[model samples]
Target: MGAECCNKDCLKPSVIGYGVVAWLSSGAALGVGIWMLVEKSTYSALLASLFYPVTIYILIAAGTFGFIFAVFGCAGAMTDSRCMLALFWITSFVVFAALGSTGFLALYYHDNVLRKDINIRQAINESETNGLKDVINMLQAEVSDKLTFCLLMLSFLS
Candidate 1:
């Protein structure tokens, strides 16, 4: 009889298999995140948004779910929990499928091209607000980076 220690042994009959699962799942998720962030350069929250169609970017949104699955599956694998792995796998599949289907639906609803209509008044407001957000994020990142570097330098000097 297998000893059940906090549901640990119940998770994987094979520790080796669990390790493999975690590695592969985590690797796949890394690839997905890289493709989305690096290849597509979605560095900003506005660009990171999943609510919009991938057609808006036309490069990397297609694989976003794969990365999510990989990441979640990797975590599950690390934890040796069958539940998390299954949850992430199924959810990732559903999300990917939905994104693909939604892309098609957009073809009909938006007539195959993102509408370019603009309300001048709204445009002005949006431009103003978005600009401030962009500036804030940039400044925050810069400040954070500087702080980290200074701390590292201080540590080395010490």
Candidate 2:
């Protein structure tokens, strides 16, 4: 079925649909990433002092890759290049897997920090030697704030 798709002059609706969806989603992802990076630019220098620059570089790379892959998807669909399509599938799977694992970790950390028994605020106040406690407190506050904001927006929509 896959091989036959390459030879057919008449492209099926499904093929066109897939190409369109891939292109649109990739573009959206790229736009959102850049927008976020730009919006946070004012605080980036301060953030760099406290955190590694690797995450900043990774976000830029991911956005660029998404834009490039969207173009590849459209071209591959138009030209019916099996190799391009295969590469797209492979990369997409890897991206999805990475995102899934990151999401799991985020949720796990969020739950741990929110547990009533964990006195995060107290830990931050008491710890002097390890700076990691401060980082943990910040992460917890950020994640909890974002989650609460999102829920409020969702509730309004519903």
Candidate 3:
């Protein structure tokens, strides 16, 4: 008589756990991206370039793909399927690269392109749309209030 033994996959649990975390984070990213695009859209008029909306669009795309990749990862882990795992790995890499590039480009545009090209005062003055003007005025008031608050805090501390 012989005793039978079955192989145990030790990494399956960790993979599924990672997939769950990734899925939640991706959903958050998607939500934030959509929210920014829809709610803060008026602020886009102040920008001289398309980078603002483009970055948000990229975030939305990456989040959507990340969600899909996480599903693949969870499915692969559960089924012990190599093909799904490979797809997950590849999609994850693509999403990572896209996010990294978007961050880099945003920083570069803020420092170089925005500073040189965008004049907030000019944008506000040239804005023909009432909504854009209202948004600009609102932002100016908010900034003024924040600056006043900061100054008061500093005076109190000193």
All candidates' lDDT scores? Answer: 0.54, 0.58, 0.81
| Model 2 alpha-carbon miss at residue 31, Å | 2.7
Model 3 Cα RMSD, Å? Answer: 7.6
What lDDT tens digits, residue by residue, belong to model 2 across residues 91-141? 666655544553455466565545522554555577775454656556579
Q: Which candidate should be chosen as best, given lDDT against the real structure? A: 3
Q: What is candidate 1's TM-score against the reference?
A: 0.29
lDDT tens string, model 3, 33-68? 898788655666665566777888888999999997
Which candidate do you rate higher for lDDT, 1 or 2?
Answer: 2
Question: Model 1 over residues 1-158: C-alpha lDDT tens digits?
Answer: 44555365655444435445544554554465455545344334333235343444322343455444556665776776788778766866665565467557556656322332223334545675665356556757988999999999999999
Which stretches of model 2 miss by more than 4 angstroms?
1-12, 41-60, 112-158
Clashing pairs in 2: none
Give the least accurate 10-residue stretch of model 1, judged by summed lDDT: 111-120
Model 1 spans > 4 angstroms off = 1-69, 109-158
